[model samples]
Target: MSFTIYLRCFNGIVLREALRFVHQKERFFSALVRPLVWLGIFAAGFRSVLGVSIIPPYETYIPYEVYIAPGLIAMIQLFNGMQSSLSMVYDREMGSMKTMLVSPIPRWFLLISKLLAGVFVSILQVYAFLVIASLWDIIPPISGYITILPALIISGLMLGSLGMFLSSAIKQLENFAGVMNFVIFPMFFASSALYPLWKIEETSEWLYYVCFYNPFTYAVESIRFSLYSQINIEYSIGIVIFTFIFLFLSILGYDPGRGNLQKKGGK
Candidate 1:
C-alpha cells in the first residue's frame, strides 16, 4: 500500500475507536469521576496528615495533593487502559474482535489502533482532572502541563498493553475481578504513586527495590519529574521498554496458533 493510503487507514481505525468512546458518554464520565474523587476528596482529607519527606527534585514538603496528582493521572490512564482491553475481551466474546482480526490490516496495526484509541481517551480524562485540580490550586508548573500530554500518552499505552495482555490470557470476564484485586492495587501502591522511593526505602530497602522494579513506578516518577521540568532518564527508558514488552506479549497472546483466544471458543 502507498504511504498515504496506509496512513489514512490507520487514522480511520483510530477515529472509529475514538468515536465508540464518544458514544459511550457514561463510561467517559465514570472514568473522570474516579480520579476526581481521589484527587479532590480523598487527597484533600489526607493532605495535611500525610508527612511527605523532602525527596530529590522535590525540594520541599509538597502537599499530598501536589505529590499525588501525577499518580492520580497515572491511575486514570491505568484504569482506562484496562477498561479498553476489557472491552476488547468483550468484543471477542461477542465475536467483534474476530471481525476486526479478519480485516486486511496487519494484526499489530489493528491491535495498536485500539490501544491508541484508549490512550486518547485516557488523555482526555487526565486533562479533565488537571482542570479540576487547578480549581483547588493544586496545579503543577504551567510548563509541566504541556509535557504531561506525551507522558500521559506513554503511560496510557503501557498500561493499556498490559490490559491487552491480561485480556488475551483470561477466558472470561469472571476472572478479571481477581486480577483487579491482586494486580491493580499492588502495582499502584508499590510504585511511587502515593509516596517517594526514599520513603519506601527508609521503611525497607527491599521494598524500595521492589518499587524500583515496577514499570508503573517509572511512569509515575516520569510524570513527577516532568511536572518539575526535570527529565527522568530511568522513567523514560522504563516506559519505552515496558511498552514494547507488553505490546509484544499482547501480540503473542492474540496469535492464532497459540490457542490463546481459541481456547475460549473465540476463533
Candidate 2:
C-alpha cells in the first residue's frame, strides 16, 4: 500500500529469481554455451569469409568475431527472456502463479517486478559472456563496457516482455518448446545478428526487409553501437518503443479480468 511495501515486493521478486538462477547451474552454462559455440567455432570458420566493413560502431574494419559479439550478447538476452517465460508457464501449471496474482500488490507491478527480475538474471549472463569473450580477445573499450549497461537493460526488457506475451498464448508447458523454436530461430536468423543487413540485402531483398523490420535487429544494433561508446539513437528509440509495446501486451495478457488468465479459468 505504501512505497516501502512496493519496494519490498520488488526486492522479494528479484531475489527469488536470482536465487533460482543461482541454483540452476545448467541454465547458466546452457545460456553461455550457445553463444560461445558460435563465437569460438562458427565465428572462427567465418572470420575469413565474413570480414566486416567499417560500420558506425566500428571506426575500422573488424573481425567477424568482433562484429558478432554484440549479436551474441543480444542472443543471450533473447534466450534468457524466453527462459523467463518458460518459468512463468511452469508456475502457472504448478498453481504458484495464481497465488502471486491474488496478492494485494497490483498485477502490473507484479508482472513488471518479474520482468525486472528476469532482466537482472540476463545482465548477469551477458557479463559472464563478456568476461569469457574478453579472455578470448574480444574485449571492447573499458568505457564501452560501462556505457553498454543502459542499452542492455532496454534490450533485456523488450525481449523479456516479448517472452511474457508469448507465454500468455501458451496454455501448456509442453507446447512452449515448439513455439520457442518457431520464434527464436526465425528471430535470430532473420535478423542482422549473424550478418550485416547489407549482406542480407545483397542476397535477397525480402529477407533484408525482414531483417530491417525485426526488433531483434534493432536490439543487436543498439548493443553493437553502445559497446563502442556510441549511441544509435534510432535503434535505441526503436528498442524502447518495442519494450513499451510488448510490456503493454504482456500486462493485458496477464490481466485476470480480461486476458488469457480468464480463458485459463483463473480466479
Candidate 3:
C-alpha cells in the first residue's frame, strides 16, 4: 500500500476508537472506580494483614495502597483491553469489522492499528488512575511516573492482543461477556495483582506456580518495577514474547476460511 493510504487507514481506525472512548465517559469512570475500591477498601483490610512491612519494590515500609498500586494499574489495562475486544466483537456483528477486514489494507496493519487505539486508551486510563492514587497520597516518585510509560505500553499491547484473539473466537456479545469471566478474573487473581506469589505459595503451591507463570504476573511485575524507577528484565522479556505470540494467533484467528469468527460469519 502507498504510505498515504496506510496512514489514512490507520488514522481512521484510531480516530474512530478515540471518538468512541470520548463518547463513553462511563468507561473511564468505571475503570477508575474498580481500582480505587481496591485501594480504598481491599487494601485497607490487607493493610493490617501485611502490617507495614518492606516489599521488593519498596525500600522502606509502605502502605498497602502503595504496594498494590501497580497491580491496580494493570487491572485497569486488563479491563480496558477486554473492553476493546468487546467493541471489536460488536463491530464484527454489526458488519463493520467485516467491511474493514475486506479492505485492501493489510490485515496485519488493520489489526495493529486497532490494537494501538485500544492501547492508547488503556494508557490514558492508567495514568488517570495514577493521578487519582496520588491525590490519596499514594504517590510514587515523579520519575517513576515517567519511567512507567514503556512498561504500560508493552503491557497494554500484550493484553490487547490477547483480547483480539478472544474476540475472534467469540461469535456473539453474550458469549464474549461470558467467556471473559473465565479469562479476566482468573488472570487478575492468579497473578501478583492482588497478592504476592510467595503469599500464594504459603497457601497453595500449585496456585503459586500458576501465578508465577501467568503473563499478567509479568505485566504487574514490570509495572511494579517501573513504579520503583527500576526495570524487571524477566517481565519485560515475557511481555515482548507474549505480545508477539498473541498478535500472531489473533491474526490467524481473524483469517477467513479458517478462523472462528469467519466460520460463524460463513454460517
Candidate 4:
C-alpha cells in the first residue's frame, strides 16, 4: 500500500505538470523558437565569418554549424532550466508553490518531481531541435540518439537545480532579468560552446582555465561526446560532480528554516 501511494504521488505530479504545459502551449512554442533562431539564423550567418581551428573532438575541419550544435543544445537546456526556475518563483508569488510545500510527501520528493517535469519538457524541446537539424543535414551519429538522452537528463538536472537555487535566492522577478543578462550570457560565451578552450587558450590562458572550470562547459562537452558516441571520462565525472553540488545547494536553499528563501529581503 505504501509503494502504491508513492507511485500515485509521482504519477500525480507528472500528470499535473503535463496538464500545465498543455494549458500554456504558447510558452512551449516560444522556447522552441528561441533555439531555432540561434541555429537557423545566427549560426548560419556567422558560420563562415568564424574560422575553425583543430579541436579535440574534431579530427578534421568541420562546419561551424556542426561544431556549435552541442553548445546550442547546452544553451537550450540552460534557458529552459532558468525558465523553469523563473516559473517556480512566479508560482511561489502566486501561492501555488506554497501549497505544494504543504503536501504530505517529503520535500525532496516534491523537488525531484519538479526537476523531472522540467527535464521531460526540456528533452522534448531538444529532440524537436534535433529533428529539425537532421533535415538540414546536421544530424549526429544514429547511436548518438540513444546516448544523448542520459546526457540531456543530467544536464537538465544540473540546470534545473541551478534555477531552483537562484529562485530561492532572488526575491523579485525584476532582479531575475539582471541575472539572465549578467550570469547566463557570460556563462555561455566563456565556455567551449562558442569556441574551443584551446583556441581561447591562444588568446588568453586564464580564459581557457575559466572555461575548464565552468560546469556548463563540462555539460556541453558531455553532450558533444555523446553526439559522436564517444565517451569523455572527464566530462562524465564533471557532470556528476556539477549535478550533485547544484542539487545540494538547491536543497539547502529550499530548507524553510535555514534557506535564503524565507529571509525578509527575499519576500
Question: lDDT winner among the candidates?
Answer: 2
Question: Which candidate number maximizes TM-score?
Answer: 2
Tens-digit lDDT track for model 1 on 1-267?
577766877788789878888899999889888878888798888877778978866887788888888888888888888888888888888889888899877888888888887898788888888888897777777888887777777888899999999989988977778778877889999999988788788999999999999988878988788777788787898899999999999999988888487787773
What tens-digit string does per-residue lDDT give for candidate 2 at 1-267? Answer: 899999999999999999999999999999999999999999999888876788777888888899899999999999999999998999988888888888999999999999999999999999999999996689899998999999999999999999999988787789888966898999999998999999999999999999999999999999999998999899999999999999999999998778997787652
- Per-residue error at 230 for model 3, in Å? 0.6
Off by over 4 Å in 4: 265-267
lDDT against the true structure, per candidate, is 0.84, 0.92, 0.88, 0.85
Q: Which stretches of model 3 miss by more than 4 angstroms?
A: none
Q: Lowest summed-lDDT stretch of 10 residues in model 3? A: 258-267
Expressed as tens digits, the lDDT of each residue in 47-84 for candidate 3 is 88775456677899777788789999999998988889
lDDT of 2: 0.92
| TM values, all candidates | 0.94, 0.97, 0.96, 0.94
Error of 2 at 254 (Å): 0.8
> Could you tell me which residue pairs clash in candidate 4?
none
Which of the two, 2 or 3, has more TM-score? 2
**Total backbone collisions, model 4:** 0
